[model samples]
Target chain A: MVDLDVEEPNSGLFVKGKLEETNPVYKMVPVWEKDKCTFCGNCQKVCNFNAVIQLHTQVLVFPKLCHSCYACSELCPTDALPMKPEKIGEIKTFHQDNLTFLESCLNIGQEMAVQVIAHTNKILEKDYQGQLIIIDAPPGTSCPVIEAVKDTDFVLLAAEPTPFGLHDLKLAVDTMRKLKKDFAVIINRFGLGNDKIWEYCQRQNIEILAKIPNSRTAAELYSHGKLIYKQIPQVKQEVLKIANKIRQLSGEPK
Target chain B: MRIAFTSQGSTWNDPIDPRFGRAPYLLIYDEETDKLEVIDNTAINQVAHGAGPETARKLFQAKPKVLITGNGPGGNAARVLENANITIYIGAGSLTVEQAYKKYKNNELKNY
Candidate 1:
């Protein structure tokens, strides 16, 4: 079971329970030993991303281009390829009385974030069958970000009130739409600029879940590596209210 | 005669399609005839992502007189093609197949 504590006033909500179960969606890469390799180059030949190369003296694998599909190992004729557990990221689980915290980080020099997402899902206990999952995804609209949100029930897209944020938010929204995922918006650091984002949301009929004002206290808490809800009790109450609103929208039990 | 152009994505060891997008079309222009036949290319069907060495070997099987291509040809691709002693025209994608043959006829284009 998990609990979500909101950290904004008139903008926060809280949720606590076990989330739904999702299947594992990411795969790890496999390394092949060329000693048993016949140099037929089937693995190199079948790679769509050109991750594997066949040199005259030796074969080469570029980890940056690898997607961990294990296609090379699956198709190796000589059985030279073997898959091992690769570390692309970690999942941190924090516990409080009624609040849960989870954060995911990607490893350095890793091109594919899917593996991290896979590991993140793995870290969550399957026994928690009725908890809420609140994911803070990495920024972008590419494949990595897409994979991060594959199993999400509701995505809270955080967009800043700026032209650049609007541009990238459109891409992110388009990507989510393509995936057919339900989502809402959170206008972070509100009141610093005009309501252009709100106006756009109203015109498009996109739901505005919440709006958070700029706060130095929240900034300081984040800089200190502390949860805003813990540093400020008001934020925690707000997060609980937001969670209730989300529950109402999702038709889940309060 | 079948000739192939060698480049980053071309299969210099096998007879394949020429990589057209990355470099000039490796066109074997007939001297007296304007007939053009594509040689070994890593970019067959305009797919310019990977090289096919099998394509290069296939090109060697066809045995053309002049192999015309672009710059950066001194890789594994160039070495395998040069084994046949076929005249290599570096940076010749700008010339038409007929012009390539004419330049060769006049002994103007030389191998590097």
Candidate 2:
């Protein structure tokens, strides 16, 4: 499983593995050179981020504010603004038996997550042509989620049955439709909320692959960082049902 | 000396907008000229990011010596104004544009 939730990646905690490899990822930011600068004010004008400011004495560059668009560097008249790589995040690989979990994490205080997620997608998954890859996408159908699910063959949306859940689920479904991607839904904490979710899904013709029941035992096990399927029969059955549906979708019928 | 304020409306009696980045109007009071200039700032709200900084960029172009807003501009906006040698006085959220100016004169506002 590749966890693309770069902001707060804790998917690896569910799986036991030894750390295999770690790689740092960087994004480019403009650095100002004092001597090379001609006080042209070109860099400041070109920067949409307001990251580069030209004062009377010297030029100022705010590293955190830069979006790494390279506009200032490319447009600088005197080559005062040059692009430099700044570490933004890291990718870590863990191995246990036949499972390889790739976890990518964005460094704290970083503004962007697309680079880290895109980099994570490029590594390892390319060579696994026939293997089953389960991706954990970031919450919300925004830019980060777009970067995570854009390349996937299928998207499985996990949502609770609350009013908030129905709202977000509708958004995700709309986003998937807009992206022209085939997707399914899995309603979690199924019994906890009203039947509005069901009514909405039925009206929309959205196929629900599985419904994971809300159980005290499952919640307890999950809180303890233990896989609920191992101890709870009801949860295990639902997981198996979802796996079978996935197999049928993959055309690997058992 | 000229002072800038984020205002809800174009008039001096309008309440000051605490949010500098997405304020409806930017009001500049030119003490030297005994005049007030109000610029529409609704355009920058449409920007995807850097609203604070972009607003600051526009605010700096007017060359205000000091900024009086409800709450101050955020870090990104603050940096740009600071670099431009503009002083920021905040905690004017409850006051009108004219009242905020009075507070500024009386030194009742907190300098941010």
The CA root-mean-square deviation of candidate 1, after full C-alpha superposition on the true structure, stands at 9.7
Q: What's the number of clashes in each of the models?
A: 41, 0
Query: What CAPRI-style quality would you assign to candidate 1?
Result: incorrect
DockQ score for model 1, please?
Answer: 0.08
Error of 1 at A101 (Å): 3.9
lDDT per residue as tens, model 1, A20-137 = 2322323456676868888887887787755566654356665556676778888998788787666555444445567655545555555456666655655554634357665556
Residue-level lDDT tens digits of model 2 in A191-237: 98898888888998988888899999887887888998889887888
Chain A TM per prediction: 0.77, 0.93
Give the fraction of reference interface contacts each candidate recovers: 0.09, 0.35
Q: Per-residue error at A7 for model 2, in Å?
A: 1.3
List the pairs of residues colliding in candidate 2: none
Candidate maximizing lDDT: 2
State, as a TM-score between 0 and 1, how close model 2 is to the true structure: 0.93
Candidate no. 1 TM-score: 0.59
For candidate 1, give the lDDT of residue A124. 56
